[model samples]
Target chain A: MSTPLLYALTGAVLWGIGLMGLIGLRHLLRKLLALNLIGSATFLILVGLAQHHNGPDPVPQALVLTGIVVSIAATALGVVLIRRYFHLTGRTELESEVPEAGRDEEGHSG
Target chain B: MSNWLMAGLLFTPLALATVSLLLGFRQGRALSWLGMLLQLLVSVGLWWLVRHEGGFYYTLAGWDAPLGIELRVDGLVVTFLLLTTLVASGCGIHAGFYLEPDRPWQRYFWPLYWFLWAGLNTVWMGGDLFNLYVGLELITLSAVGLVALGGQAEALRAALRYLLAALLGSLAYLLGVALVYGQFGTLSLADVAGQVRVSEHALLMRPALVLMLVGLALKTALFPLHGWLPPAHGIAKSPVSALLSALVVKASFYIAARVWLEAGVAVASQWMAQLLGVLGAVAIIWGSWLALCQPRLKQVVAYSSVAQIGYLFLLFPLTFGVEASVSLHAQQGITLQVISHALAKAAMFLAAGNLILAVGSNRVEALAGVSHFLPFSLFSFGLAGVSLMGLPPSGGFAAKWMLLQASMASGQWWWIMVLAGGGLLSAAYVFRIYKASFLERDEQDHFYHPDRRLEVAAMLLALASLGVGVSGSQVLSVMAMPFEEVQ
Candidate 1:
């Protein structure tokens, strides 16, 4: 197999692992890291597969660059919100993740 | 003139976003009025231009497709642009008075609101797959900002969940874009569609399409993937909730429908189409049932949104592998459903906000005797609910009528049951609200009164939802205009 194809396959494997981590992890910070991992895997598959077929295409490379900027912005926003949530509630996990906090489903902070 | 109109349409919200960020709430409110008026005029001009001149492609910075981004100024796209201007301006007007301008964070609302508007316009006009991804991200992040604006614990928690869900969806969609580019070596949706139309191994692209659809579905809050939507929608400030429910979710669904329509004939199987329809059917029944059970008023409305969104997915089954006329009918029905739902839901949320403001509580039981004190807002809520329940002389009814015809034409008798059952189930939930408000209670006499302007904003949207039923044919004609290429 070509080098690019091998990279794409590795990306596919990483994507599965990242998705599982995202779903399985309860901590918000760990979830954010898993999301970043998924974003990296997607960028890998994007550039790897495009260059594998077309012999070094710039379009997918450009797309990957834009994707990186967007994911960073998203991650930054997530961190800010998670930090604020932690400060206010003093909990590092989602309410749904805790069995005791399930009764507050309809509770509004206001 | 048309080029200038396009520039104004695209540039106004972005400029407003930047300018609003530097201004205080009062100054921002004054400036946004002018900006909204300019946007409204530009949207009308673009709609008129597209109707007379037909659709054309607007390349950004003189770069053609396959190398640079292109904006598709099509009939359907311009229609959505006008719809966005109307619904967004309505929400903005309500936000001006609804938000307490004295709060420090309230200043941030205008900037985020304008950014969300710009992002929505981008999604409607975006012709390139990667550009659409960026636009979707822009919308998602700004929407998260809006949801978390109050900085309350529940609001922050809801915002985090929404952000995480939206990010996962975006990554899935990006993966699909990567796969499609690898398969076809193009990022422009039009170019990809053209190639898929003639490609011998079109089935090879099915995986990419499925990934994109699934991602868009999650963002759109389709059933089974909708766990993150209610809290986010219910916990946000009223105007923010109106904007999120009215337009944000529809943005993702719009891209999915565009992608499916352009290439599903070549790559989709009958089994896949039927599977989507079945899921939609379940969403209608299950979502409505849940909506009926919710104790909070906004939760009920949010869950109803889930059910209403299900009606849009019938487009997949009705169009796929069907005749040309059947597909066209389904498309028109779905478009009408989208337009009407946006108007009605915005009106409902705004009116519900007024009711909550008056009663000083979010629970449905607190609405007892609300009709006595706040008859106008309550009336507006009921009027919007009329459209939601698909009653006569409403746009929702017109949309369902068209869908009924399409299902019959396509010989999909199974979907007929879903359409009828969903409508009745919606009526059950809507009336539950009506019933709660109508209960006469003498003990709850103390109530707060909202400004008259908030009621007017909501009433106008509710009227539009009702009036669109009569004008449905004209809107469909605009959507039917032929495309003309321009250099």
Candidate 2:
């Protein structure tokens, strides 16, 4: 129908795909990426939808903008954690492969 | 003056948090406690005023909704405000002892803690979708920072996963708001509800709902989307974990419930409600089973959170189609469950933190002689567990009873079974901890001694859970007052 509605549908489909990827993937980084993708899709949909209500709904757009900034901050934090996990246990998956003593020194297993 | 009060209530902690960043690692503990004390006082004063006045609403900069921001102070918001402040106070005091004075990361923890507090308060007071989004982001950023504050390898890793999940959730919620805004041209909850027209665009509305619900579900850690929680919560410091579990997760659920109610979406297919109930049932069963299996004491508590979240989800089916008296009862039950869980879970985590400090290990099996060393902490832990198990004279029991009645009255027999099963599972995990704590030991081994002050804080919260149970009728009356006009 409307262009804004079309964009919203596209964003929704992308989000669905991202969620599926997140569930299907085993790699921690891949899961994070999928989550990021899904987040972007949601933002796109929201911004697109806001376009139809008026010339531009600053409130929803502002909210989504805030969401993007926060998402980036969260992603940065996640990346740092991933790096540390790789350094400590030499693995990214949460499930443990190391011995109990090794895990104690590194701080966690799962 | 009202606008100033509302603004102060929301921004003061945030300002303090940012200022603490300048003070850095050296005075982190001192500043944290100072900030927390101020927050506690403000929250208490606000609670008293709201209780006396019934409720209050502030239009930001004297601008009305659909044009400018609005912050509403009601019984529900005040109740949550009280819980957040109490937990922050306890955590602040306990952290002073829990953290080593010379630790490098203490600098970051204080600011983030306050920032989280600010975000939490904003969520409680926020009256519209856009304001909620801002609140949620502030919360997400600060919470992620706290997770990473541990600075250890696992803490960093857990923080990363947590951040990713939180971002995804925010995105979905943002998208939903955009759709609602495009259709209705308003971000205020009441405005959106009044102008909502879902007839012409079934295709658009369905997807929007799905995105928002899925996003929030991820943030709330409702069963299937809960992959990030155990690791993130378990690896963080004890006080941080306590705050995250007890208060942070509840924020997303509160927003979701608010949207669902305010949107007045014609109770989307019965299947959706059933699906949510089914997932909730699974979470209750699965979370308990996982908690029972965890060797680490903190992991056990973390997994227990998964099960506890299930009880919150049970509200969906029980409250569906509920109107008038039944709606009032459901609302009361849900609010009680939320408040009771916050108190009990925070106490449980604090007690567990004490035990871990005393025993010098997080392993449950190694806690054989902890009761001898930390008797007060253990006692409080048991009290909290009683609430968790939904036993008589506890708030958990009251919440469960109300939900059970709602289900029966609605002819939803299946949900009754789910509730009973969840309660039994809750009892099993709680008793597991109790059994561990009480096991008789041959040799008395002296481990590290925890500070008496922390023990007192944990015990106080545990007692609050019991108090909520005893005063259930009064608390429900307060929670019901604001909603009466809506009905």
Candidate 3:
């Protein structure tokens, strides 16, 4: 198989595995990691495709570059939110127990 | 004049935001307000120009499409641009009173807010796929930074989760673009639209469409891919939450819609559109159910966003059936719905922020008798809810009306059921908050009187949501102008 086709197949497999991991994993952090793997797979596919005909397509490469930067920024923000949640409740999974309505035990009443 | 105004409108916020970063926390608040005021003035000026002179296109570095970036200001772009600037400015104004004056994070918020403004405008004006991707990155990065701006441990965690999802989404989009470029050798959306031939590479095209749609779905936080949204949106300070929900997610969806209409719809399978519509329907119901169950006020609003976004996705299946007037109506309805939702949701988040400030808590139950403490905020919340609930004399009502008509006309009454059911669910949750706010509590309320300026800003947004209903015809006319040929 040609390199682009090989890359596309690998990307498809990685995406499938990553999605499976996302579905199976309960921990938010783990799910995020799975997502990242899927993202990396996608980048590989894009870069491979852009290399078609022995010449790189600047357009797709440019887009991938932009996408990479965006992904990092979003990852930074997501980490911050995860940290906040962990501090507040001491767990990574979404809090199942809804806080009672009338209390400010969390000290965030304001 | 128009071209320069467009550039200024897009870049001035970034310039001001950058300057604020250098100034640090001491002068951040003042700088933020100044930046906001400048953005508002520029947006208004651009809106007027678009109104009077029709849309204008600006090619960066004097290079045209297929080579350099192109920013085209159409009715849709102008409307969204106006919305972003308005919401950002309002949030800026509101943040002044909402955030502690001495908070160290103020230094970061102002510059990021402006960067976000510049990104939003660029995304709105972007004429091609690559340009759109650039705008998307700018938006994603700035938004991620904003989420982490809170700097609390939980906030950091949530920001990380959001970051991963965004990255994955961007990657998927990039892959799709690469596939298209390999097949067609063009980056310009218009060029791709003209060049794409379905028969030559059906298999390749299908996967590309799937990748692009899935990526956008994740970014838009469509039902199953919505893991990052609730915590990220809910935990962020109210102003940031408003922008993230009201504008940022919509930017991705806007691009997806444009791409689908311009390229994918013509060459892709009808089943794909139907599949998207199905997902949207699922999201509407699932999101509403989840929102109804949330304990926190902000979480409730965040979940509602998932449901509302589903309605926007329904436009995909409805837009492709050229012979069907019902599909056309559905398209129009979805367009109107998008605008109305943006306005209403922004207002709702702002009002929720004010209530949280007043009650000194984010918990919904603790808001007993909050209406008495902050009557205006409550009033604004309720009014915005009117739109969310699709009640009469509200833009939400007009949007739903069109949607219902389209459903009936198209005989796609299953979607009608979803729309109606979603509305009921929305009403249920809204009323839950309304009931909680009005409960008679005898204790003296310890109100954290939010800055009057912020309250006014929130109310102004709420009023704007209501005003959309009055100006529905005008807005629809504008949305209708683009894709007239397609219709």
Candidate 4:
């Protein structure tokens, strides 16, 4: 198999593994990490895919560059929100909170 | 002048947002009204230009074709563009009262609100794939930030969940784009569609199409993947919820539909479209069931949003499966559904927000004595509910009628059952509010009156939905502009 195809497959596998972790891991931090892994995998695939179309394609390169920036911004937002969630509830996993109303103890503490 | 409208649509909000962020609260509040007014004019002008002058496409700088970015405006784009502008402007006005003009948080609110508007407009008018990815990120980030503005533990947690969902959705969408670029070697939708029209590249097409569709489905909050919507939309401050339910989610749906319509239709098989329709059917049933069970008023509205979105997905199969005229009617029906929902849902959220603030509780049971204080909000809520329930002389009914007719004409009676059942289910939830609002409670003694201006702001959108219901032919005509061109 070609190097580019191998790299592309690796990226896909990483995405699968990351998705499993995102779903199975209840910790908000771990979920965030899993999300970032998916990002890294997608980016790697973008780079690998750039190889398929004769020589270097600037479009996929440009796309990867933008994707990286977007991923970083999303990661930053996730971190900030995760920090707030931890500080408030003292827990990393999100409890569905469907019936958790009438309680603002954590909110008041902050 | 018309060309400038497109650029103005993009840059004006962005420029105002940046300036307001630097200037802080007082100046930002003062400038946001002007910013909204400017947006309204530009959006209306864009619709008119596309209506009379035909499609408008603007490329970045002088570079053309596969090399540079492009922004295209057509009737389809304009329909959503106008909806975004109107609801956004209305929400901006309401935010003034909701956040109070003098509060420090409103400072954070204005810039992010404008950024969200800019992001949505970019998505609506985006002609190319790469630009859309960037806009999706902008939208997800800004919207997540807005959700956290509530700052309570619940709101903050909801914001985190929202951030994760949107980020993952967009990244997955980007992966698809990478494959699509690798296949077509072009980023522009027009160019990609043109390539796919002649090239039977299912090897490249199927994976790219499924990846993109699933990604967008997650973002659009279609059922099964819609776990985060209720919390995110419910916990945010009213204006943010209004924006999220009314327009933000629609942005991703618009992209998915555009891709499915313009490019994916040729490549995607018949069953794929049918599967999407089935998903819509399930979302309708599932979402309505949950909405009926939710204790909180906003959560019901949010889940109802999920149900209403299900109706839009019905367009995919119905459009591709039937006679040309049937397809035309389905398109018009779905467009009407999209617009009316934007107006009605935003109005409902604004009114619900007022109700929640006045009562100091979001529970439906707490709506007792609500009508005594915010009569206009209560009245407006009913009017919006009329549209949501697809009742007579409302936009929802008009859309539903067309859909019903199309379904009958096409002989697809299964969707007709789904449509009628969804409407009945919607009525059940909407009536729950009315029933609770009319209840007499001693809490009426301490009720806080919602602002007169905010009441009027919410009322205006409800009234607009009613107006569209009666005079939908023009909207249909304008929507046809894009349809005819596509043909």
Candidate 5:
């Protein structure tokens, strides 16, 4: 396979793995890391595609640059939120969702 | 002149947000209010310009497409711009009173709120795919921050969940945009639409559309993927909840509609349309059922949003399933639904927030003495609830009327049943609130006297929701849909 094709495949695999981790992981920090992994996978695929042309595509480069910045901001904010969540309650996982049939099923008192 | 106004439509909020951030709350709140009022004027100016001179596309910084970004002003954009201006202004005014200006929170809230407004305007006006990704990020981040402003543990946890889920959605959307750009060699919506119409790179485009649509669905909180919505929208402060419910979700959904109707309509098939309708149907029934079960007032409204959003999905089927002539009607119907929902939902949240503030609790049972104490706000809530229930002389009723007509005309009788059932279910929850509020209490519970200005602001929005129904016919004419008009 060509270099771009291989990189694209690897990126796709990383995305799949990251998504699986995001869904499967119960730890808040792990979930945030999984989300970052997905972001990296997307950026990698974008960079790979940018090289598909004879020279690097400027548009995708600009997009990736901006994407990296946005992803950083999002990750930073997420970390702050998780830190506070941990500070408030020592747990990392979200309050385990009760079954749909559980008692809080009705209007809950705040 | 209009071009400059168009640019102002995009940048004024950005400038105001920066100014507010630096100036702090004392000066920031006044400037934010002025910025919103200015946006209202600019939005109307753009709407009039689009209506009179027809929609136009301008390249940012004099750069052409496939290179520089584009800002598009069209019927869809105009309609949404108007919604953003009106609902945002109302929410801002309510928030001004909702949070005491003296509190340090104002320093934080005003800046983020304006940033969110700026982001919403970008979503509506951005013609380039990358710009939209940026816009969605702005909305998501600002919205998550707003949800966590109260600093409670529950609020923080919910914000974290929302941040993760929303980021995942954005990444997925970005991946789709990347794939589309790689295949089509362009990122502008118009350019992409042209490419997709000729079925160029049909293979790549299909997956791209799937990724984008699925991501948007998650962000929009449709059906099963909506696990993050109730918590995020419920735990936030009242004005924050109102903004999130009223406008934040709609930004992503607007992009979805723009893609489906404008760019990828040809690639989208009958089954895909039907699939959206089915998911919507389930969201309606499931959301309403959950809303009925909610013990707190805010949760009921939040779940009701999930159900109300289902009504919007039905538009996908109604638009693409039928003939071209029939699709126009469906298009108008869905647009009406969007606007009316914004008005009614914003009004409901503001009023509910007012009631909750006065009663010092969100439990429905705690609202017994509220009607007696804050009758005006309660009256506002009732009017807003009337619209929510799709009762007569309200925006929600008008939207439902149009959707009903479109479904009938398109012969999609199944959706008709869903609409009817959803409305009745909405009535059940709305009525539940009404019933609780009307109950005669044994002991007199003291209610906090809400700010008079805040109550008036809430009343104004509720009345506007009712007024929109009276002028419902103008909706189709005002939107002036380019695609349907051409047909």
Candidate 6:
């Protein structure tokens, strides 16, 4: 098997794992990490797939660079929002994740 | 002169965003007024140029396509550009008076607003797939910032959900772009379309098209995936909600439609189009039903947006596999729907804001005695509602009329029923608001009158929505102009 094809297959597998984590995780922080993993997987596949066919390419590499910067910005913004939410509500999980009794306390606090 | 106009169209919002960040809110307001006037002129100038001179590609920084970024200044794109200028300026003018001037956090609003505007223009003209992805992120970040500006608990929660959903959607789209580049060895959408037309192995790229469409559909908040939209749109300040519902969501949908129209015919299956159409129909019915149940005024408006967006997805089924004339009618219909919905929705949100301001509460029950004190804003809301309900002499009616024609011509009678049912459901919710306001409550009059400018801002948008119905033919004529290929 070609080396680039192997890399692209790895990316596809990682993308599946990241999707599962993002969907199954309840904690917002974990969810953010899962999103980051997905980002890495997408970038990997982009570079791998482009290079697998042709010998070398600069365009996909450039796209991956931009994608990384965008993901970083998104993560930073997510952290800020999550921190503020935690400070206000004193909880890390979303409202739907909490049970009935916890929601009552939340209603009172809010 | 035209080159300068294009440059101005691209430069003004970004420059003003930077300048606005440095100044105070009031100072930013003053500067933004001048900036908006310049934008309006530039947008209109470009629209006129594209109409008369034909559409052409503008290679950014002298770099050609498939290698560097290019801006596609076509009939449909310039039409959206003009629509953005009109709707965004209305919201901007309303925000100036509506936001509390003394609050320190309010200063951030202008910068975010302009950045969102810049992002929107980029998406409209972006010819390269990667550039559109960047544009989508720019819009998502700035919009999330706007929603979370005050940083209250509920606002933060809504903003977080919005951020997550938007990020996920963008990544899905980027994944598709990666596959397309791998297959075609080019990131330019035009180049990919050209190749897909001639290539025998085009079926290999069908998964890529589906990924992109699903991503954009999620971003557009099409049904079942629309969970994140209401909380974010409802919780944001009125002007922010206006911008979000009217423009931000449409940006993603515009890209999706462009992709589908350009290359979908070659690679897409019939079931995919039908499935999209089914989802759109369900969104219309379910979203309107949910809108009717919301207790808060703005939530109803927000949910209404979800329903209206469903109308846009109908473009997919109506156009795919249809005759050329049928598809043309469907395209014209959807374009009118987008423009009219933007104007009417903006008007409704601004008017609802004024109503909430007058009553000092967001609940529908609290609006019991509002009609007596604030007939003007209520009337504006109702006028916008008329358009939403697809009533006569409104832009929404004109759009639905063409859609009905296209569906009939295509022998797809089922979508016709969906269209009619969606309109009736919308009327039910719109009237619910009216009913609540008309109930008499015996209490001392404690209403606060909003600024005259806010009322005027909303009233103007409402009037424009009605006017678009009369001028629908002229707009369609412009959209029919031929494209001049890249040199």
Give me the candidate number with maximum DockQ.
Answer: 1
How high is the CA lDDT of each candidate model?
A: 0.89, 0.78, 0.77, 0.84, 0.84, 0.90
Chain A TM-score compared with the true chain A, each model in order? 0.83, 0.80, 0.80, 0.82, 0.83, 0.83
Q: Local error of candidate 6 at B86, Å?
A: 0.5
* Winning candidate number (lDDT): 6
* lDDT per residue as tens, model 3, B286-341: 98888888889999999999899999998887776645677667766777787778
TM-score of each predicted structure versus truth? 0.97, 0.90, 0.88, 0.95, 0.95, 0.97
List per-model TM-scores for chain B.
0.98, 0.95, 0.94, 0.96, 0.96, 0.99
* C-alpha lDDT of residue B121 in model 2: 89
Instruction: Sort the candidates on DockQ, descending order.
Output: 1, 5, 6, 4, 2, 3
CA displacement after TM-score superposition, residue B404 of candidate 1 (Å): 0.6
**Runs in model 3 lying further than 4 Å from the true structure:** A10-40, A51-110, B197-202, B322-328, B480-487
Cα error, residue B410 of model 3, in Å, equals 1.9
Q: Say which prediction, candidate 3 or candidate 4, comes out ahead on DockQ.
A: 4
Clashing pairs in 6: none
Residue B421 alpha-carbon offset, candidate 6, angstroms? 0.6
Candidate 4 on B338-429: residue-level lDDT in tens? 99999999999999988888888889999997777788899989999999889989999999999899888988899989988999999999
Writing each residue's lDDT as its tens digit, candidate 1 over B261-291 gives: 9965678889888888888889999989988
lDDT score, candidate 6, position B344: 99
Q: Give the per-residue lDDT of model 6 (tens digit) for B1-487.
A: 6678878877889999998999999999999999899999898888878878889889887888666788888888888888999999999999999999999989999999999999999999999999999999999999999999986888888888888888888988988988898888888888899999999986448988998998899899998788889888988999899999999999999999999999777788789999999999999999999999888999999999999999999999999999999999999999999999999999999999999999999998899989999999999999999999999899999999999999999999999999999999999999999999999988847899999999999999999999889899988777777788747
Off by over 4 Å in 6: A96-110
Q: How is the predicted docking of candidate 5 categorized under the CAPRI scheme? A: acceptable
- Per-candidate DockQ versus the true complex? 0.53, 0.40, 0.31, 0.43, 0.47, 0.44
DockQ of 5: 0.47
